[model samples]
Target: MVKWSISILLIMLLNLAVTSLGNVPNFDYHAFYFIHQWLPSYCNQKGTKCCYPPTGRPAADFTIYGLWPYNDGGNSLQNCPGSSYDVAPLKAIQNMLQKDWPSLTCPQIGRKFWLHEWNKHGTCSKSVLDELAYFHAASNMKNKLNIFEALSKARIIPNNQFYQVENIKAAITQATGYRPFIFCNHDAEGNSQIWQVIFCVDKSGTKLVNCSGSPQGQCAYSTVKFPSY
Candidate 1:
């Protein structure tokens, strides 16, 4: 009787672990909320960890911070609440740029300005939309490429082989035109992550440094940089 009880307990524990590991959060407004609550804590911000850890081993030299908006084949703009359009992330990036180049205009910042806006709020004002259209038209003329094709070429391999250094550099170049400000990625197991830009460096290399963490301890490090994009 004692042996049977112990075996059953072990089986239950194993099953629970598998179930927890396999669960991926559904993408919705609640997804952002879940990421906000869980990611920081998982990275040891407040000494709490996630239920399912990331698969990538933590890096010793890099830090990635801030959350990159995830679009799970749905329109984020359609899902955001309120009339204001939830443009907090673009405003945040604009504020950052103003600190460096006070005279910079929205158009001068190039595709990055639009990418940041779309990534965060899922939509943009008419001016930004016009700028994006112009940028895409010009880019196609110069490179014989379209936005859809570019994005298709830029997709990352969503597997354990994610930390490919060459692929990372290529992705950064393709997305941002300039080299990455940082080089970090989302862990497969976590619902959300954050990458904060510490500061800029004047050196020939990348300008920003960031830290990344999962909603669990699966990926934890401070020096991760954003990919060139």
Candidate 2:
């Protein structure tokens, strides 16, 4: 009887392991790796001294603000410094939403925005917002809106030219099937104003990434990887 019980326990453990592994998506790590390679070099060459967080942007970083003026506060948007709010991340988020819910509507999408923006403020940082918008739009939703509806109702774009939340979401989802995680990172130095996608899971099972760059060069990119299980 004891031998039979032990065998049964082992089988259960094996099944559990299999189930966990199944949940892991077949991710295209190469695309992300290539992006990383470009970031550092770009920062070294093109990062301007006058840009927001005033010190200097990094050459290569995963966050949108590092690449463009999405969240960098200096621009006209004025939500936060270094907070330009890129359309790409928002598109990614939108795509994810569509994947989660195929029949989503404008109102439903609005509810999500309100929840993420207000209720779950901390969890959905700038990066996450981008990802959410991107995924939500890309996954589904066939109808396209004019400039006014897209900007006012959806809150996707800042101006007519730039791809706001709706447009960003659609673009990202079309590019990548999966949406990236978003979070903030701050180290010992006081710099603290950066954003990026959470590439890996942290030790506590949370997705992790680094987003830090202050007015002084003191705060810069740090090696932030997901924690081990």
lDDT for every model?
0.31, 0.29
lDDT of candidate 2 over 85-203, digit per residue (tens)? 33444453543333232222223343343333322221223333343432333222212212223223444322212222224334333444333333323323322222232222111
lDDT (10s digit) by residue, model 1, range 177-210: 5333322334344422333212221111122222
Q: Which has the greatest TM-score? A: 1
Q: Evaluated with lDDT, which candidate comes out highest?
A: 1
Residue ranges of candidate 2 with Cα displaced over 4 Å: 25-27, 30-229
lDDT of 2: 0.29
